[model samples]
Target chain A: MNEYTFPIVFGVFIGVVTRLYLLKTDYRQYPTYLHGKIIHIALGFIAAGLGTIAVPAIMEKEFAAITFLALAASQFRDVRNMERNTLNELDQYELVPRGKPYIEGIAIVFEGRNYLVIFASFVSTLAYLVWNIWAGVIASIIGLLVARKFMSGSRLKDIVDIEYVEPHFEGAGLYVDNIYIMNIGLPARQKEILRYGMGFILKPKNFNARSTIANLGQRQAILHDISTALGVYRDSGTPALVPLAKRDLDDGRVGIFILPQEKDIEKAKTIIGNVPTLENAIRMPTKSEANKKGRKLR
Target chain B: MTHEKLILAVITTNSNKIAGGAPIFTCDTREEMESVATNLEAILDGIAHSLSDELLIIVKH
Candidate 1:
């Protein structure tokens, strides 16, 4: 049995591991500080290089070699520090632009100093790899994980210009949708209640002023869903529930007048045809003994 | 006020030539919703525009 057989196996494993690391994780997109750790790497390589000549000059050949070895070891230690510093900095959001880390990760393996450390560690170790080799793999996995956490699943800009284009129609008909998404689970005691902006528009099919007012009152109870769907304005800290942002009408239509309940009714009067008050008005959901899932307008 | 009034406003946009009669009334208050039918006076200026055949009726009541 070869004593070195186990070591050889371990060596191959480390080599494969280090090579695999270079293959993955593009570090080019990482922030300047992260990639800037090139300073530590450069210093490490410079020391490694200078040690080759300087250590031989300082003492006997064997002693010089040992000194160079020690220097090389310290340089590796510094490289590990730099790697770790880079990892720590990259842990947060927007730490880097995004794509840089993905691009430069492979290049790290090709560098002469990292390559030297990777091979030597494999050659010398019977079992354990150099600490940074293990750390490098760990740091890479962590970086990848951290990067994914910062990346957004969807962009808000894509959903912005929402157009609900409908088929063209003539005569008088109406299309209405509420302002906000209904969240029923909301506790009533909470001051911030869900507001649904109600929307209603009229097309003059056969303009009968009298029947329209009477019928509108009758339909009040059913319009609870429409009212609840109205959107609330989040202006001046208080949410104003405004249903209609805009309106359009054809010629041949005439509005009677507006009947305002309060002072600010003028704003509303100008927007819709004058106000017409029905006998029964809209009311929110009342306090009930039973658990009420249904609406209040009814 | 404990009994705060719930209001509703409806706006209509129509072309000038097509619009006729009194302007409809819409309100900031839900209670005044029915008052609009009684008013025969065309409060709104007829939307007698230059070219468009659409009429507008901004109703608040």
Candidate 2:
């Protein structure tokens, strides 16, 4: 019917579709409930609506309408906080808890996705206003693809070599491919560890990858994900049962040990490969002059 | 503290260092600490201790 109405509705629809596509749980099955999905969809719709209306508002010379974007920004920030809190609460009951860094990363992604949806809608609407409905539809499709690409962060497998190793003990201390995991005191617990424990060695591709895996939070997140995917061995008040990740001091290799209910190495490797490299954990060795000097000498 | 009741003796290299809010006893050598722990082990009934490598955390429950 109306020129503005068609573009606005079409833009909003594309934006919502993009958001839903990004929300699909591939590895980390979180926010899978109907209520969680509904809330996200509703938020995405609002974001798309706001972005779609901005084109018409600007065309009509209503500058004050731009302020609503700032409002949306704050709303999105609150959504991030809500997500962080919910994940934190859920983490307490987990056998292996997703560390603070991972939780923060996930929350930030959720907030950023909303902004992407808004951008998609805004671009498509603007294109429609300039040309026609066909151009708007084409632009919206491109925007969706771009948003999808931007949302995907590099996984652990991209930077490191993950291989399953056997868990062994040297006296009281547990060793996984020369990396000293921890000490297992009781023989009974040691038996269970040998029987059920899955060991993995992550060999970093470069110095930067080395530093990233070395981060305590990143290692904890890996352990959390692996344990979450393959059920963790439930042992109350037993510190020995706790999953551990130890690094090889000589090389930048990391060893992870987890006693899961199911001893499936493939599933464990897949989970490790899917672990999102935490934003804070990424350490660039090239930034430091000492590292540069040392590399030249080597 | 609950750890105080659980920990029989924390024979660390550094006496001043406190662990888990439990009292720390300084021992000059590993051999000396092992002897002391052995003596304590005999005296204390049914109290099994864990000797950790990192800090030699001798935890008993």
Candidate 3:
């Protein structure tokens, strides 16, 4: 009945729609269940309500309401912590565990999306109050496009060249390209490995990418992603059958060894290329002060 | 002190090569050595690493 009623409802609706668009349960299978989605949607709704009311609060000279954003920041931070704890707990039992860095990256994304929701709601509401519904719709669309741009980070393909290599046995040592993977003594076990195992070498595109791909957590994330997508051919008791990534010290290339049940080289390569380059694992060595001074560190 | 990697057992055709530390299983031939190492690897849930043609050690990683 008030001037703010339609605008508030419109803002909240747009915010919730943006949240739903972002909360996709992709191949990562996070928030896969109905219950998990419910929890996030509920939190998103709260964020939208908070954002929509702020414009009216400001117009009424109730500047005190702006302080509620600080509270929302803390609330979203808790969502990050909750995600981290849950993923960490579940990781232990996973066939190919998502490493700490990958889990942290996912948690950060969950928290960040809520802030995007708030931004979308606030902008849309402000437009509605200032002009009309058409302005509000246009503002919401722009907000959504900005949200989409911020959501996606670089993929593995952007930084490295992935080439398939057949794993070979040099004496008893298993090697992917030139990088030594591990040793297998039993002839039967070695036979089984040769039959099932596949290898790929990741060549870093730049000096900055070398350190990033060499990160143990990043390497683990690669293994986890590929294994989840292609189905790992391994069991608990078989330690020798596990997938591994080893770095070549001479050239900064990484050797990845995996045992996938479905031996489709092209499909596996596509999966590896699609893996998100973790935020925590990114190291910008070229951007450092010493490097910027023209000293060739690499 | 606890070790991250421990050699749980050793199976070798040449018994003179290794003596102390981990429990050693001496085999008469290469076939005997391979079978013994394989069994130990499965039983102990450790990886069997070959030192040479005649020697294998099952180590927990």
Give the winner by lDDT: 3
- Tens-place lDDT per residue, model 1, A1-298, is 4533444344444444333333333323222454454553444344334333332233333554445555556655655555545544453332111122322321232343444434433333422233424553454345334333432222211211112222111222212322221111112201222122223333333223223322333223112112222212323212211222222333222222111122133333233332222222222223343425444322
Position A114, candidate 2: lDDT: 97
- What CAPRI-style quality would you assign to candidate 2? incorrect
Worst 10 residues of 3 chain A by lDDT: A289-298
Off by over 4 Å in 1: A1-27, A30-41, A54-65, A94-112, A115-298, B1-61
DockQ of candidates 1 onward, in order?
A: 0.03, 0.10, 0.77
How many residue pairs of model 2 clash at the backbone? 0
Error of model 3, residue B24, in angstroms = 2.0
Query: What is the TM-score ranking, best to worst?
Result: 3, 2, 1
| Native interface contacts retained, candidate 1 | 0.00
For model 1 chain A, give the 10-residue run with minimal summed lDDT.
A181-190
Better of 2 and 3 by TM-score: 3
Q: lDDT per model, in order? A: 0.30, 0.82, 0.93
